[model samples]
Target: MANKIVVPIKQVPETKSVKMDEKTGTVIREGVDSIVNPLDLYAIEAALRLRDRYGGEIVGISMGPKKSVKALKEAVSMGVDSAILLSDRAFAGSDTWATSLILASAIRKIGDFGLVVCGERATDGDTGQVGPGIASFLGIPALTYVSRIQDLSDKLCRAERLIEDGREILETSLPAVLTVIKEAGEPRLPTLRGKKRAKDLDVQIWGNDELGIDPDKIGLKGSPTRVVKIYRPKVARKCTIAEAKDEASVGPAVDRMCGFLADKGVLQ
Candidate 1:
């Protein structure tokens, strides 16, 4: 049997278009369009490349509302063999820790896996904790910020990791997890055949009961973090728009702009 590599993905609202509900402090998804988390695409691509070279199955997993099926289908179009979605009211309001626990349970139910790949972070939270959190829950070695995969065999996997100051090369055995960085590479586009196959692929939907997850460890009660408040930062800078108003006034406008910058300590 070929090794099975699982990739966990998320559907996030387009950052620029996201609107927050001031009363509930939650994202307003009504008008906001959602897309697959960009970083996770790199992870998916990495898994696809490995499958091409080593021969294995790639499975995409996601935890969200039913609408997230779009994200899973998108993964299918990217060549994932199959996909799974974990959805239920029980999963609502889960923090990173709770989310990872749920994902770990689903992975266990899969019964067999050689590797797990994930994006470094989600654009919404930007905490960059879930990937490592999943590895910790599974008790597997996790190589994060991976920019390049040097080797991947049945027994071993080697990759180069990007850090703040420099890069580090790491080698871990199979059954490990990797959280890839954007430096890895751009993801491949879905082909027409892949899209056709995606439409026919039956995506499995699992819930807390299906995975036998504990109710106490799933929803709001299971989450450790709480939002205190949500508000946009105040803009404190004063702006003065200067216009020449006429061709002959251009020189004066330039002089005025230089004076304003100098007064603001932007120029010496």
Candidate 2:
């Protein structure tokens, strides 16, 4: 197994502040504070555990604007050995496919790596596709929804993954991708030393120029899927209160509920 492990993370708007542009069908990130994608914390924790058990360097990578360096710094503060930020205007508005392509290219640039760990999905997109997409681009096995790592070696990884009805164990060769789940473990908080190191670390920045990926296969231009429309579902309800202070009012309350249900066609 190689001595290097890569964990891909994302910066996302705080859940409560997330909004969408109905016209553009995109997230409204302006004026919103962003944090490291919550699920990705699990991925980072998993990588850290692996590094602890076996000796390896954990590298955190992210693709976004220059400001996204904050997320990388946060990852460093969480105990990653190093971090890289992929920033370029050419990478704006990338869909999952385009994103996976960009990240896979970066991994190739990093050269020898034994494993890639990622979160099950991003909260914003919630697609759960990038991890598998990276595996597809890298021509490696993709084990997703991983809950636990049972064993690991230079050549192979055995893990437990969640399925619809239950969990199943899977063994895949090295140089594979694993999309971890929350069951892995809770993420650790950053320490004072880690924070100081993060402040001093010079995070490397790479772009399309460095990765040399085809412009036609990146950003919005390369995306095959598009959001045509975005709108919030309307939720409207009418409340009717029938007081049953004593047994005398119980019969009327039941009759009122039945009538309301019948009117709504729910009692048919």
Candidate 3:
């Protein structure tokens, strides 16, 4: 099996406090509490498992503002061998396509990796496109929604993927990208020793200068998609109370319920 694995992670606003700037079509992260994307923890755990079994180095990478270093440190505390942060003003407002391109560039700089692992999706974006996008940029196979790694070798990887109906087993060449689902396993908490190591770790920070990405093709300027608008969905409900104080009223109450159901097309 390839001895070096790369895991791409994200820092996201706490779900409950997530907000968007309608004008800019970007998440409002200022003053918001952030944490390592929960789903990404599974990816970290999976990479750690692979490294433990195969004996390799696990490198964690993240693209965000300087504050995002927190997320990388969290990954390191969970046993990542080291971590790197991709931060720069030019990287602001990057969509999945641009984000993937930047990450792929970083991976290229850390070349000779055997595999790349990622979370199924990021809560803030709720889009699972980055994993496959990275694979496309790297010209490697992309295995998504993978719940388990059945087997691994220098030239091949067999995994169990979660599908709509059930699970599917497939094998792909090494140096592929895998988007891990929660079913893979529960992530472990950071141990005291790991925490100590992470505290002293000097995470590397790379920017556009290091990646040498074209300024016009690295952030909002490079994104092909845009959020035109965002609004809370209006949920309107009408409550109709049908009282059945006695047995004599039960039939009428039932009829009313059925009528309401029919009116709403719930009963066809």
Candidate 4:
């Protein structure tokens, strides 16, 4: 079988600076700097390295709003042979479980891809659930938290899986799904030639119907979970505004800060 590898990726929020829309209570991704989920970069790097060693096509697939094209472009600039954007308004509020089902459907339709790789989790969700979810839906074995690709062949592939305690070497068959960790490998820098190529090549866009996906099995209607609510972590700013003619007023501000931390159990 030819080595046709697919990497599933996402553009995730800047966890340190996330803001939520007041009305929707969902993350305000607009105007925020989104990065290729770091973990996915590892997966992509793994796929690219494999493709480089053994001749094959590296396909990048992502599902998100139109804005998510930025992430796909970055992958293309890293030498991915093909890319697919799966977007639909009907997929608005899908949680991990629903998202996995949609991706599983899309993967099934990709026809000849031999290996599928994904990040262990998205920085925003941190669910670490989607990779395995896709595996379950597709009825395939999944190896996750992969730190290194030990050895690979068309029929059998081996990897070093990172666990909480240490690591383990695991082997699985060709059609297996892999969820990679950041420790797997560093992602490659985009070359001038690769970037130019990415700019010219059109990324294929797929809708639910194009994937031959049933509405009842995809988007909101087919999703089994929902985002009941989303919100930003409130940051309390401490400003004295103390019209203090002298430095003495700093005492109240200091005491207030100390008390706040004490109440929050951040200080003893």
Candidate 5:
């Protein structure tokens, strides 16, 4: 098997509580509870399973604020051999495309990896673009919605992917990237020993300087997609309460209610 595998992970604000910064066009993370993107846990599990079967090093990598280090630590606790954090003010406000570039650069710096795994999508973004973007940046083959792996060797791997109509089996060369669906499997909880090791092991932090990424290819400055404006669409509803005067009038009341609903374009 290849010597190394990289799993790209993300930490996102809880879906129910996520807020965006209108001024900056970025997520407002302060005072929000964050968790590793649920889908990414499956990717991590897939990496761990691959290592178990193929004998390779597994590394978890993420690009986010310093708080993201916590996500990486969690991955280490889940049996990742090591973790890397990409953090810097220069990386703030990156969209999926720029984020992928930064991550692909970091992976390139890490060198010699046979596989890269990532979640099908991030809860906060729901764009499902980063994985393929990373593959594009790295110039490698990529597979999305992978649900099962049939075989894995040092130079090649084969897997089943879920598609719109059904599923398809695919085989690809090594050094490939796979974006895994949650249906692939559940992630294992961290063992006590793994937790202790995670606490003791320092996660290496890399920045633009370390990865030598071009300033024009990272952060808000590099993001091609822009949020020109963000506003809550107003919701307007007119409520008409109908009450029947008595059983004798119930039929008339029902007719009136239906008429009101029809006037409101709620019924035919």
Candidate 6:
């Protein structure tokens, strides 16, 4: 049997278009449009491509508010074999560690999945920490910032990870976690058949109690870090434009700048 690949995604508020309250520093997400994260598209595409090549089922998982089903529907329309949404009031305000613990619990419930894939980070949080957090919670090997996944034989999986200085190639056993960056591949368009199938396909929705996660440890209570405040940065610009009409004026222009700096004590 081919290995089953699972990809978990999220629907986040379009922070790009969101306006914040300058006084409170809280996003005005109410009535704002939500969309499936761009990075998650790469993870979903990777799973589908692996399934097509290796002959397995590609399962899509997501966590968010009740409205987040829209995100999974989009995934289903992209040819995922099945979709699961984890939703509940208790899941609100969960940080990376708590969120990963809840997701890991759901993964265990699904059972028998050989590989897990995820995006490098979510645009909303920009933490880039959940993928590795999931791996740590599950005690599985995780290779993140993967730009390329070369091979996925049941024998082994080889991938190239992008680092700041260069790339690192890694090989890991089956049942490992792979976190893909957007550069991994261009996601495929949703097919008509896939859209039709998604119409009737009911995505399984899991709750905190159903997944058997410790209530206290799977939500805000479990998060250690809290943002004391959030604010938009204010930037001040100081620029000088210099012009020299002829070669003779170049020396004078340079001297003018030097004099300005010297008078300001910027140059000693």
Residue-wise C-alpha lDDT for candidate 2, range 1-268, written one tens digit per residue = 7989999999999999999888766787768899999999999999999999998899999999888889999999999999999999898888999999999999889978999999999999999999999999999999999999989988999999999999999999989999999999899999899999999999999989999999999988988889998878887977788678899999999999889899989998
Candidate 1 structure quality by residue, lDDT tens digits, 33-140: 999999999999999988888888999999998888889999999899999999989998888999999998888788579889999999988988988888898898
Candidate 5 — number of clashing residue pairs?
0
lDDT accuracy of residue 267 in candidate 2: 100
Flag the better candidate by TM-score, 3 or 5: 5
Winner on TM-score between 5 and 6 is 5
- What RMSD does each model have against the real structure? 2.3, 3.0, 3.3, 4.3, 2.5, 4.5
lDDT of each: 0.88, 0.93, 0.93, 0.82, 0.92, 0.84
Measured with C-alpha atoms, the lDDT of residue 49 in candidate 2 is 94
Q: What digit string (tens of lDDT, one per residue) describes model 3 on residues 1-268? A: 6668999999999989898998889999989999999999999999999888888999999998888888998899899999999999999999999999999999999988999999999999988999999999999999999999989988999999999999999999988999999999899999898899999999999999999999888778888888898888986977798889999999999999999999989999
The per-residue C-alpha lDDT of model 5 at residue 164 equals: 95
Estimate TM-scores for all models. 0.89, 0.90, 0.88, 0.82, 0.92, 0.84
**What is the overall TM-score of model 2 with all chains considered together?**
0.90
- Kindly provide the TM-score of model 5 when superposed on the true structure, using C-alpha atoms: 0.92
- For model 5, how big is the CA root-mean-square deviation? 2.5
lDDT of 4 by residue, 1-268 (tens): 3458888888888777677666544566778888889889888899988887777898888888888888898999988888888888776656788788888888888857678889889988788999999899889889988888878777888889988899999899878889998887888999898899888888888876686666676565666765566656797987544343468877886777778788789999
TM-score of 4: 0.82
Candidate 2 — which pairs collide? Answer: none
Error of 1 at 177 (Å): 1.0
Question: Which regions of candidate 2 deviate over 4 angstroms?
Answer: 233-258, 262-268
* Candidate 5, 1-268: lDDT as tens digits: 5699999999999989899888877899878999999999999999999888878799899998888999999999999999999999999999989999999999999998988999999999999999999999999999999999889987788999999999999999988999999778889999999999999989999988898888987899999989888888987976677888799889988999999889979998
lDDT of 5 at 82: 94
Worst 10-residue stretch by lDDT in candidate 4? 237-246
Structure candidate 1, residue pairs in collision: none
What value of lDDT does candidate 3 attain over all alpha carbons? Answer: 0.93
- As a TM-score, model 1 comes out at 0.89
Q: Model 5, which residues run further than 4 Å from truth?
A: 243-255, 261-268
